[model samples]
Target: MQRIDSVNVRPDVNGAGKPGFHDNADLSGQDATYLTPTWLNTVQEEICNLIEKNGYTLNVASRQQLYDIIATNDSVTALAEAMENRLVQLQAVLATKSALEQGISYVMSELGQHKTASNPHPQYLLASTFGVHIPMTAAIGRTEIKDENRVLGWNGQSSDWTANTGEITWGGSLSGSVEFTPYRAYGQFLLSGYISTATFFDVNVRVFNAEGIETSLIKVTEYGGSYASYGMNKVFEIPKGGKAVIEYRVDAGYSKRAQMTFSVYVDDRVKVFTPVGLTSVVDATDFTESTQNDVKSDYSSFPAFEWFYGDTNGQYFELSAISNMSDPVNKIPHYHRDKFTQLEKDLYIAVQAGKQTIESPSDYAVIDTQILRARTDAEGNVVVAVPLSMRSITTANNETLVYTFVYYLNEPDVTGALPVGLDGEHKIYVRL
Candidate 1:
């Protein structure tokens, strides 16, 4: 510590045309340290804090006296010690009050233990996931395209397609009118109920933007041979409160022999797609031997079935291409693109209802919550910060929960790119 020869604290005493200047001719007889502006600020702050703690007013006389004493190195050190003690006391009180008011009890309970019944399928519940089965089309000119993305394959025996005459005629007798419904306006009116018969039916599903012009055509395949079933899904994003159209060519089908059913189960109940937690009951059995060892395998064993239903399990869930269209918070992907945190990974594993976490290379977790809060560190590895609510466990024999994650094709930066032409689909798989 250095002793001060004297003290001079004033602003622009002489007309030097500059601020914060000091002259030191009279201070030669005194023992004092010439404190720099930064050091002086530190000393002043400490003194103010001490006075505040003791309930004293910062008067001019007191401030000057303290400034004079702190000119010596010994007093400066003592002042620092006094301020630290008072600051610690103030911090302790503030922390305690903050904890009480913020409802820390609930946060503690959620963090301490794991939750059971994480995933259970409910009865009468609308299908958790939304999807459209796109049958082969004549415009694309290829019926034998590989089903690379969908979990299920097209099991139809024949891919043959024939065009229908524009005129709705059954041997020159038009008994009914053909109604056209656009897919863009689907939310306003949706069709529900199972179509009992698998017959060759023609329905022109149209989509439009704000201009009301037809944007795309999703043609439903004519299901003919062996009582087969074929469908199409048209997914797009529109402005808020904007509309689309679905024109069903109800008259073009072979309806004279049998009335083919075109059931459209439409409602707002169809929620946005979610990624199931890896430890969820529906995802419990999705893990494989390779996944347990953290080894990357060609075939990742994802959650294909729930344990409660035993070995008779298969994937079954509807898909809606309009995930980001809903504008719901969690319906879209999270901002973070990093690896999972310890707490997040633990919560994911703990929330699995009936599934057990297995150590295998094929095993992975699915995120099923509609919303996600994810973050990343300096490293760019992807991880989930928020835990998602998952599907429920099922007791039905061979019934399985389907894992759903969005796949971005071609443009990773774009949220609603179609999965048709990209390098397959960017699908994230998990089981619960």
Candidate 2:
């Protein structure tokens, strides 16, 4: 597969001035020199026919052709409108195909060990591997400054801190704590919940380990003189053989009710190796045939751009003017051209981020003409970073050129056969 750098059609305009498209003809005219209504209808019908012939699917090349038409004749009101609508529908199909391909690639890359004939669905295996959900009780256990009127529960109701018949004269503070045990070993743990408060007070929430050591999870100190609500999603590592303790505090001088509901989800203990021990380690010197084949196949299938639209061919009928569109001399001012250019870069980044990664420091390969670097951290987490220079696009810009490029890649088979050795000598544990 080949990678694309810039889809800029104009060579004369340098830097940010290039509109990335060419003006073939005055689309505002109805003459034969411009795109006629008859030509536009014919092209639309032909594209529709091609899509129907291909089982209502447009290949990467066909989609690019349509995008070329849309880009070149976008100034033609009626023709551009029709093609734009069709392009949107086609893009939807392409997006779905892209998602399916990415999903299959992920299963093939990440859960290759779990692929089996007996359980052909890798997703189910993946779910069983890391879908352990041990629901913790969200009830508030104890409080520091307790009051009889203060209420706390996990029944989706407001936990109130009210004065005892105007005893404190709208000034008081309350705190509570809860403790729960984790179900598994070390993994990513997510704590998500929301808190609603009234009478304009400050709320602080924290999580502590089994040793009474506080882990700073959530803290809100700013107070507005009205009701306020907050939502939190915090991810933390759960140490081996340890539990979590949740603590919350509310301070206010007026009548305030703070309602909070939270839950914890711990990642399941799914190991890359069956028996996670020293014996499970393989000798670095020994390379099997299957291992060599796997490495070769991965290198052979590295994702790349299969096709790209550099110019408008099918949409612009006048061959001479259309050919001259890429010339550096004939330049047209397009205000939104930079915005479209940025969008192209963004799309490339998104695709590369989803699919590509650096294996080592020396492997400096470019994808879609941009260099991406990946490094493993101290905790063995791969962090992929792409260098970006920000350029702002605003509606205030008057001269802008818009060019469209449609990228299409072959979708992988979602219902394909699973890999061998999926049902190896390991017990499949399902979460209840």
Candidate 3:
């Protein structure tokens, strides 16, 4: 785009009485004397020509750019300063973008017939209208209030649901089986067995689905004749009307008496769980109504997910989309400092990709676990020019924290930024 124009050779006139003006008498015969004034001038012109040809020649339109680079342009117009200015501009743009994105962090990703399963709970989610529970909703701290909470299941009383087999005589590697069915949604199951006159017999245990399919199997090395029974927890998700069958068999042909039992129970926990699709119903379109709504109140079909049961209902719409410690993807973005989205006023989920979607409260899990999972999304064929996501969060509440400080009583009264006073007492520090 730019180039320098070349100038031909040229030199100033020579001095009047310069040396070698003539073949001097003393140095007359030197190799090429006096190269006279004309000759000297000619050679000087040739050197000047070479210099002109060697130099860069440009026909630049903006010669002022060259002037600024070659001459210090007040230090402010240099390339480094220009770069710094551009960086400042870029940072300003990025800061604005981050503020805006975070402002709407818990908001729905998209609109249209969207559906989510928080706030009102899936049981109370209206069928015709899409509903979701999102950050800062009314249900933010009420996850433990549902009837399905494990703490609610135990009243310091014996479990209302447990099945067992009494001692029975059997021989020739005989097996015993026990089955238990639930009338309502329940979780927290355990397995244990006893044997009479075991005499160190090898045993095999198994679990089966309703279709009599063996879903899991395990072997035990020995069972003693002692009265102590072996116990194990976290059986599996067992839905209502669905029966779980467990069977135990001994390897020896010795005649022995044996029994097995399984129970649904829970222990004391710092956290609680809730049932889905089961929220308080109100008549007004706004869920804050005083009267009960005539629509979507039947919770008979809502699946109650127990805490420690892993994730949400598989055959259902799941996840609070509510901001919790592990699943903080949904929370009140801000109170006075933040703004809430209108998935209908800080409500439920908006599946990023699909709109016409259906989620039922997960009935049961196919895995053995006790911890409720974080808000999870199904993996899919999602590819984008710029991939992004968000997860809400706060401090975990599983336990409490305490701090301590120590000081010696005999040190000198040290002053001004010392670790301890001269009296040996340590100084307390408050961080800014």
Which candidate should be chosen as best, given TM-score against the real structure?
A: 2
lDDT of each structure?
0.29, 0.32, 0.29
- The residue-by-residue lDDT of candidate 2 on 157-204, one tens digit each, is 222221111111112233455544433333344555555553333334
Alpha-carbon RMSD of each model: 33.6, 33.4, 39.5
Using lDDT as the yardstick, the better of models 2 and 3 is 2
Which candidate should be chosen as best, given lDDT against the real structure? 2
Clash count for each candidate, listed in order shown = 72, 8, 33
- What are the models' TM-scores? 0.18, 0.22, 0.20
Q: Is candidate 1 or candidate 2 better by TM-score?
A: 2
Candidate 2 Cα RMSD after full superposition onto the native fold (Å):
33.4
Find the 10 residues in a row with the least total lDDT in model 2.
Answer: 293-302
Q: Arrange candidates, best TM-score first.
A: 2, 3, 1
Any runs in candidate 1 off by more than 4 Å, and if so which? 1-199, 224-241, 250-256, 261-432
Which 10 consecutive residues of model 1 have the lowest summed lDDT?
Answer: 277-286
Model 1, global lDDT: 0.29
Q: Which stretches of candidate 3 lie over 4 Å from their true place?
A: 1-164, 169-174, 184-188, 200-214, 218-243, 250-264, 267-432
